[model samples]
Target: MKSKTLLILTGHTKGLGHAILDQFLSLESVQVVALSRSSLDLDLPNVTEFPLDLSDLNALEANLTKFFPKEESFDRYILINNAGWIGEVKQVGKLNPKGIQRVMNLNLLAPMILTDAFV
Candidate 1:
Protein backbone atom coordinates (compact mmCIF):
# COMPACT_ATOMS: atom_id res chain seq x y z
CA MET A 1 0.00 0.00 0.00
CA LYS A 2 1.19 3.53 -0.68
CA SER A 3 1.98 5.63 2.38
CA LYS A 4 -0.60 8.36 2.82
CA THR A 5 -0.70 11.82 4.36
CA LEU A 6 -3.81 12.35 6.50
CA LEU A 7 -5.20 15.87 6.60
CA ILE A 8 -7.89 16.75 9.13
CA LEU A 9 -9.35 20.06 8.07
CA THR A 10 -12.05 22.10 9.78
CA GLY A 11 -14.20 24.84 8.20
CA HIS A 12 -13.48 23.38 4.82
CA THR A 13 -16.65 24.75 3.21
CA LYS A 14 -15.25 28.28 2.89
CA GLY A 15 -12.33 30.68 2.97
CA LEU A 16 -8.79 29.41 3.44
CA GLY A 17 -9.97 25.93 4.30
CA HIS A 18 -11.81 25.66 0.99
CA ALA A 19 -8.74 26.84 -0.87
CA ILE A 20 -6.55 24.34 0.90
CA LEU A 21 -8.96 21.48 0.24
CA ASP A 22 -8.98 22.33 -3.44
CA GLN A 23 -5.21 22.13 -3.51
CA PHE A 24 -4.99 18.95 -1.47
CA LEU A 25 -7.36 17.09 -3.82
CA SER A 26 -4.82 17.09 -6.63
CA LEU A 27 -2.44 14.90 -4.64
CA GLU A 28 -3.39 11.23 -4.81
CA SER A 29 -1.32 10.46 -1.73
CA VAL A 30 -3.19 12.87 0.50
CA GLN A 31 -6.28 11.63 2.35
CA VAL A 32 -8.59 14.38 3.51
CA VAL A 33 -11.02 14.24 6.40
CA ALA A 34 -13.12 17.36 6.29
CA LEU A 35 -14.76 18.42 9.52
CA SER A 36 -17.55 20.90 9.14
CA ARG A 37 -21.00 21.74 10.43
CA SER A 38 -22.13 22.24 6.87
CA SER A 39 -22.65 19.37 4.48
CA LEU A 40 -19.68 19.12 2.14
CA ASP A 41 -21.57 17.16 -0.55
CA LEU A 42 -18.29 16.54 -2.28
CA ASP A 43 -17.93 13.57 -4.60
CA LEU A 44 -14.18 13.36 -4.65
CA PRO A 45 -11.86 10.45 -4.22
CA ASN A 46 -9.81 10.10 -1.03
CA VAL A 47 -12.06 12.55 0.79
CA THR A 48 -14.21 11.94 3.85
CA GLU A 49 -16.61 14.30 5.53
CA PHE A 50 -17.09 14.37 9.29
CA PRO A 51 -20.14 16.41 10.15
CA LEU A 52 -19.77 17.91 13.59
CA ASP A 53 -20.96 20.81 15.67
CA LEU A 54 -17.90 22.19 17.40
CA SER A 55 -19.94 24.38 19.71
CA ASP A 56 -21.34 21.38 21.50
CA LEU A 57 -18.77 20.13 24.00
CA ASN A 58 -20.68 16.96 24.74
CA ALA A 59 -20.72 15.96 21.10
CA LEU A 60 -17.17 17.06 20.46
CA GLU A 61 -15.80 15.06 23.39
CA ALA A 62 -17.75 11.98 22.50
CA ASN A 63 -16.29 11.87 19.01
CA LEU A 64 -12.62 12.44 19.85
CA THR A 65 -11.75 8.97 21.10
CA LYS A 66 -12.53 7.45 17.70
CA PHE A 67 -11.75 10.41 15.49
CA PHE A 68 -8.45 8.95 14.43
CA PRO A 69 -7.82 5.38 15.43
CA LYS A 70 -4.38 4.71 16.89
CA GLU A 71 -4.06 1.58 14.73
CA GLU A 72 -3.89 3.56 11.52
CA SER A 73 -0.47 4.97 10.70
CA PHE A 74 0.06 7.78 8.24
CA ASP A 75 3.24 9.09 6.68
CA ARG A 76 2.21 12.50 7.99
CA TYR A 77 -0.67 13.79 10.12
CA ILE A 78 -1.88 17.33 9.52
CA LEU A 79 -4.65 19.08 11.42
CA ILE A 80 -5.88 22.47 10.23
CA ASN A 81 -7.95 24.28 12.83
CA ASN A 82 -9.67 26.85 10.64
CA ALA A 83 -13.06 26.85 12.36
CA GLY A 84 -13.73 29.97 14.44
CA TRP A 85 -16.21 32.70 15.26
CA ILE A 86 -15.78 36.40 16.05
CA GLY A 87 -19.06 36.49 17.92
CA GLU A 88 -21.62 39.26 17.72
CA VAL A 89 -20.45 42.76 16.93
CA LYS A 90 -22.25 44.24 19.89
CA GLN A 91 -21.37 45.40 23.37
CA VAL A 92 -20.74 42.60 25.82
CA GLY A 93 -23.80 43.48 27.80
CA LYS A 94 -25.87 43.62 24.67
CA LEU A 95 -24.75 40.29 23.34
CA ASN A 96 -26.66 37.14 24.08
CA PRO A 97 -25.10 34.81 26.63
CA LYS A 98 -25.42 31.92 24.21
CA GLY A 99 -23.43 33.79 21.57
CA ILE A 100 -20.55 34.26 23.98
CA GLN A 101 -20.58 30.61 24.81
CA ARG A 102 -20.69 29.67 21.14
CA VAL A 103 -17.66 31.83 20.39
CA MET A 104 -15.70 30.40 23.29
CA ASN A 105 -16.63 26.84 22.48
CA LEU A 106 -15.90 27.03 18.77
CA ASN A 107 -12.93 29.43 18.77
CA LEU A 108 -11.06 28.53 21.97
CA LEU A 109 -12.21 25.14 23.19
CA ALA A 110 -12.67 23.16 19.96
CA PRO A 111 -9.15 23.80 18.63
CA MET A 112 -7.64 22.80 21.95
CA ILE A 113 -9.67 19.60 21.99
CA LEU A 114 -8.75 18.76 18.40
CA THR A 115 -5.06 19.56 18.92
CA ASP A 116 -4.91 17.49 22.06
CA ALA A 117 -6.08 14.50 20.07
CA PHE A 118 -4.00 15.28 16.97
CA VAL A 119 -0.65 15.61 18.69
Candidate 2:
Protein backbone atom coordinates (compact mmCIF):
# COMPACT_ATOMS: atom_id res chain seq x y z
CA MET A 1 0.00 0.00 0.00
CA LYS A 2 1.15 3.54 -0.72
CA SER A 3 2.04 5.65 2.29
CA LYS A 4 -0.35 8.54 2.95
CA THR A 5 0.53 12.25 2.91
CA LEU A 6 -0.72 14.36 5.81
CA LEU A 7 -1.41 18.08 5.34
CA ILE A 8 -2.28 20.36 8.26
CA LEU A 9 -3.66 23.55 6.74
CA THR A 10 -5.01 26.76 8.28
CA GLY A 11 -7.37 29.38 6.75
CA HIS A 12 -8.46 27.04 3.99
CA THR A 13 -12.02 28.28 3.69
CA LYS A 14 -11.20 31.11 1.28
CA GLY A 15 -8.67 32.77 -1.01
CA LEU A 16 -5.17 31.35 -1.49
CA GLY A 17 -5.51 28.74 1.21
CA HIS A 18 -8.63 27.37 -0.49
CA ALA A 19 -6.78 27.16 -3.78
CA ILE A 20 -3.98 25.16 -2.24
CA LEU A 21 -6.41 22.88 -0.48
CA ASP A 22 -8.19 22.16 -3.77
CA GLN A 23 -5.01 21.15 -5.52
CA PHE A 24 -3.85 19.03 -2.61
CA LEU A 25 -7.19 17.28 -2.36
CA SER A 26 -6.85 16.17 -5.98
CA LEU A 27 -3.93 14.01 -4.98
CA GLU A 28 -5.17 10.54 -4.07
CA SER A 29 -2.53 9.97 -1.41
CA VAL A 30 -3.12 13.22 0.47
CA GLN A 31 -5.27 13.69 3.55
CA VAL A 32 -5.98 17.25 4.73
CA VAL A 33 -6.54 18.38 8.30
CA ALA A 34 -7.83 21.92 8.03
CA LEU A 35 -8.04 24.51 10.85
CA SER A 36 -10.02 27.67 10.35
CA ARG A 37 -12.44 29.99 12.10
CA SER A 38 -15.22 28.55 9.98
CA SER A 39 -15.48 25.01 8.71
CA LEU A 40 -14.97 24.43 5.02
CA ASP A 41 -17.96 23.35 2.96
CA LEU A 42 -16.08 20.63 1.13
CA ASP A 43 -17.25 17.08 0.57
CA LEU A 44 -13.94 15.37 -0.05
CA PRO A 45 -13.32 11.94 1.45
CA ASN A 46 -9.92 12.78 2.91
CA VAL A 47 -10.66 16.17 4.46
CA THR A 48 -10.98 16.74 8.21
CA GLU A 49 -12.01 20.13 9.48
CA PHE A 50 -11.32 21.80 12.82
CA PRO A 51 -12.98 25.10 13.60
CA LEU A 52 -10.72 27.24 15.75
CA ASP A 53 -10.03 30.84 16.74
CA LEU A 54 -6.35 31.57 16.30
CA SER A 55 -6.49 34.72 18.37
CA ASP A 56 -6.91 32.65 21.52
CA LEU A 57 -3.38 31.60 22.42
CA ASN A 58 -4.34 29.37 25.31
CA ALA A 59 -6.93 27.55 23.27
CA LEU A 60 -4.50 27.10 20.41
CA GLU A 61 -1.86 25.62 22.68
CA ALA A 62 -4.34 23.28 24.27
CA ASN A 63 -5.63 22.11 20.90
CA LEU A 64 -2.27 21.56 19.24
CA THR A 65 -2.02 18.06 20.63
CA LYS A 66 -5.36 17.14 19.20
CA PHE A 67 -4.37 18.27 15.72
CA PHE A 68 -0.91 16.75 15.80
CA PRO A 69 -1.22 13.24 17.11
CA LYS A 70 1.92 11.10 17.38
CA GLU A 71 1.26 8.67 14.61
CA GLU A 72 3.62 7.29 11.99
CA SER A 73 1.02 6.25 9.47
CA PHE A 74 1.81 9.00 6.98
CA ASP A 75 5.00 9.19 4.92
CA ARG A 76 4.94 12.98 4.94
CA TYR A 77 3.64 15.67 7.27
CA ILE A 78 3.14 19.29 6.15
CA LEU A 79 1.93 22.39 7.99
CA ILE A 80 0.54 25.44 6.15
CA ASN A 81 0.13 28.56 8.24
CA ASN A 82 -2.13 30.51 5.95
CA ALA A 83 -4.26 32.53 8.32
CA GLY A 84 -3.55 36.27 8.60
CA TRP A 85 -5.19 39.52 9.59
CA ILE A 86 -4.59 43.09 8.47
CA GLY A 87 -5.39 45.76 10.97
CA GLU A 88 -7.36 48.88 10.07
CA VAL A 89 -5.62 51.19 7.63
CA LYS A 90 -4.45 54.08 9.74
CA GLN A 91 -1.35 55.87 10.87
CA VAL A 92 0.54 54.13 13.65
CA GLY A 93 -0.29 56.98 16.01
CA LYS A 94 -3.95 56.68 15.22
CA LEU A 95 -4.19 52.93 15.34
CA ASN A 96 -6.56 51.39 17.83
CA PRO A 97 -4.72 49.36 20.42
CA LYS A 98 -7.26 46.57 20.42
CA GLY A 99 -7.23 46.24 16.64
CA ILE A 100 -3.46 46.16 16.51
CA GLN A 101 -3.35 43.57 19.23
CA ARG A 102 -5.86 41.38 17.44
CA VAL A 103 -3.99 41.63 14.16
CA MET A 104 -0.64 40.90 15.72
CA ASN A 105 -1.97 38.01 17.73
CA LEU A 106 -3.48 36.30 14.74
CA ASN A 107 -0.86 37.07 12.09
CA LEU A 108 2.35 36.77 14.05
CA LEU A 109 1.94 35.24 17.48
CA ALA A 110 -0.31 32.37 16.46
CA PRO A 111 1.94 31.20 13.64
CA MET A 112 5.02 31.36 15.82
CA ILE A 113 3.31 29.39 18.56
CA LEU A 114 2.06 26.78 16.14
CA THR A 115 5.47 26.49 14.49
CA ASP A 116 7.11 25.95 17.83
CA ALA A 117 4.66 23.20 18.61
CA PHE A 118 5.08 21.64 15.18
CA VAL A 119 8.85 21.61 15.41
Candidate 3:
Protein backbone atom coordinates (compact mmCIF):
# COMPACT_ATOMS: atom_id res chain seq x y z
CA MET A 1 0.00 0.00 0.00
CA LYS A 2 1.09 3.54 -0.69
CA SER A 3 1.97 5.73 2.28
CA LYS A 4 -0.81 7.74 3.86
CA THR A 5 -1.29 11.38 2.86
CA LEU A 6 -2.82 14.18 4.91
CA LEU A 7 -5.66 15.71 2.92
CA ILE A 8 -7.56 18.80 4.01
CA LEU A 9 -10.94 19.25 2.38
CA THR A 10 -13.26 22.23 2.86
CA GLY A 11 -16.99 21.96 2.11
CA HIS A 12 -16.68 18.24 2.44
CA THR A 13 -19.96 17.73 4.21
CA LYS A 14 -22.15 18.21 1.16
CA GLY A 15 -22.35 18.21 -2.63
CA LEU A 16 -19.19 17.70 -4.66
CA GLY A 17 -16.88 17.81 -1.70
CA HIS A 18 -18.92 15.13 -0.02
CA ALA A 19 -18.62 12.86 -3.04
CA ILE A 20 -14.88 13.41 -3.21
CA LEU A 21 -14.52 12.55 0.44
CA ASP A 22 -16.54 9.42 -0.03
CA GLN A 23 -14.24 8.26 -2.81
CA PHE A 24 -10.98 9.14 -1.05
CA LEU A 25 -11.82 7.69 2.33
CA SER A 26 -11.74 4.17 0.93
CA LEU A 27 -8.17 4.49 -0.19
CA GLU A 28 -5.48 3.20 2.16
CA SER A 29 -3.05 5.88 1.00
CA VAL A 30 -5.18 8.86 1.88
CA GLN A 31 -5.84 10.30 5.33
CA VAL A 32 -8.74 12.69 4.99
CA VAL A 33 -9.23 15.81 7.09
CA ALA A 34 -12.54 17.51 6.53
CA LEU A 35 -13.78 20.89 7.72
CA SER A 36 -17.46 21.68 7.68
CA ARG A 37 -20.00 23.95 9.36
CA SER A 38 -21.46 21.02 11.27
CA SER A 39 -20.25 17.55 12.20
CA LEU A 40 -21.05 14.95 9.53
CA ASP A 41 -21.69 11.27 10.02
CA LEU A 42 -18.92 9.87 7.82
CA ASP A 43 -17.48 6.77 9.41
CA LEU A 44 -14.48 6.37 7.20
CA PRO A 45 -11.51 4.62 8.69
CA ASN A 46 -8.78 7.22 8.17
CA VAL A 47 -10.85 10.34 8.21
CA THR A 48 -10.76 13.20 10.70
CA GLU A 49 -13.50 15.81 10.90
CA PHE A 50 -13.35 19.35 12.17
CA PRO A 51 -16.39 21.48 12.96
CA LEU A 52 -15.41 24.81 11.48
CA ASP A 53 -16.73 28.15 10.35
CA LEU A 54 -14.51 29.24 7.49
CA SER A 55 -15.78 32.80 7.77
CA ASP A 56 -13.41 33.23 10.71
CA LEU A 57 -10.01 33.33 9.07
CA ASN A 58 -8.00 33.93 12.21
CA ALA A 59 -9.52 30.99 14.00
CA LEU A 60 -9.06 28.83 10.92
CA GLU A 61 -5.37 29.67 10.75
CA ALA A 62 -4.86 29.02 14.43
CA ASN A 63 -6.62 25.70 14.19
CA LEU A 64 -4.66 24.70 11.09
CA THR A 65 -1.43 25.38 12.94
CA LYS A 66 -2.62 23.36 15.88
CA PHE A 67 -3.68 20.46 13.69
CA PHE A 68 -0.82 20.48 11.18
CA PRO A 69 2.15 21.88 13.01
CA LYS A 70 5.59 22.32 11.48
CA GLU A 71 6.59 18.99 12.92
CA GLU A 72 3.84 17.25 10.92
CA SER A 73 4.88 18.39 7.46
CA PHE A 74 5.80 14.96 6.24
CA ASP A 75 2.33 14.23 4.92
CA ARG A 76 0.96 15.90 1.83
CA TYR A 77 -1.42 18.85 2.34
CA ILE A 78 -4.41 19.49 0.12
CA LEU A 79 -7.11 22.16 0.57
CA ILE A 80 -10.30 22.26 -1.49
CA ASN A 81 -12.18 25.57 -1.41
CA ASN A 82 -15.71 24.65 -2.37
CA ALA A 83 -17.74 26.74 0.02
CA GLY A 84 -19.81 29.42 -1.68
CA TRP A 85 -23.01 31.41 -1.37
CA ILE A 86 -25.23 33.57 -3.54
CA GLY A 87 -26.62 36.72 -2.05
CA GLU A 88 -29.85 38.47 -3.01
CA VAL A 89 -29.94 38.64 -6.79
CA LYS A 90 -31.21 42.10 -7.43
CA GLN A 91 -30.30 45.15 -9.42
CA VAL A 92 -27.06 46.84 -8.41
CA GLY A 93 -28.96 49.68 -6.82
CA LYS A 94 -31.05 47.30 -4.75
CA LEU A 95 -28.19 45.09 -3.65
CA ASN A 96 -27.87 44.60 0.06
CA PRO A 97 -24.38 45.45 1.22
CA LYS A 98 -24.49 43.09 4.18
CA GLY A 99 -25.66 40.16 2.09
CA ILE A 100 -23.02 40.69 -0.56
CA GLN A 101 -20.36 41.07 2.07
CA ARG A 102 -21.30 37.83 3.75
CA VAL A 103 -21.24 35.91 0.49
CA MET A 104 -17.85 37.34 -0.51
CA ASN A 105 -16.44 36.68 2.93
CA LEU A 106 -17.36 33.01 2.75
CA ASN A 107 -16.61 32.38 -0.92
CA LEU A 108 -13.55 34.53 -1.64
CA LEU A 109 -11.93 35.52 1.63
CA ALA A 110 -11.95 32.11 3.24
CA PRO A 111 -10.28 30.48 0.23
CA MET A 112 -7.56 33.10 0.20
CA ILE A 113 -6.85 32.55 3.87
CA LEU A 114 -6.78 28.80 3.35
CA THR A 115 -4.27 29.19 0.53
CA ASP A 116 -2.07 31.36 2.72
CA ALA A 117 -2.27 28.93 5.61
CA PHE A 118 -1.37 26.02 3.33
CA VAL A 119 1.65 27.84 2.04
Instruction: Provide TM-scores for the models.
Output: 0.90, 0.89, 0.81
Question: Which lDDT tens digits does candidate 1 get at residues 6-118?
Answer: 89898999899899999999999988888889867988877888789888888989988766746567899899999887978997579898989999999999999999989
lDDT: worst 10-residue window of model 3 = 66-75
Candidate 3 on 13-118: residue-level lDDT in tens?
8899888888887787777778888879767777778888777766777787654534444456677787776767999899888778778878998889878877
**Number of the candidate with higher lDDT, 2 or 3:** 2
Off by over 4 Å in 1: 69-71
TM-score of model 3 vs. true structure: 0.81
Note the Cα lDDT for every prediction shown. Answer: 0.87, 0.87, 0.76
Shift of residue 83 alpha carbon in model 1, Å: 0.7
Selected candidate, larger lDDT, 1 vs 3 = 1
1-119: candidate 2 lDDT, tens digit per residue:
99888899999999999998989988989889898999867777888888998988888888988886466478888999999878699986999998888888899999999888877
Error of 1 at 5 (Å): 0.7
List the candidate numbers ranked by lDDT, top first: 1, 2, 3
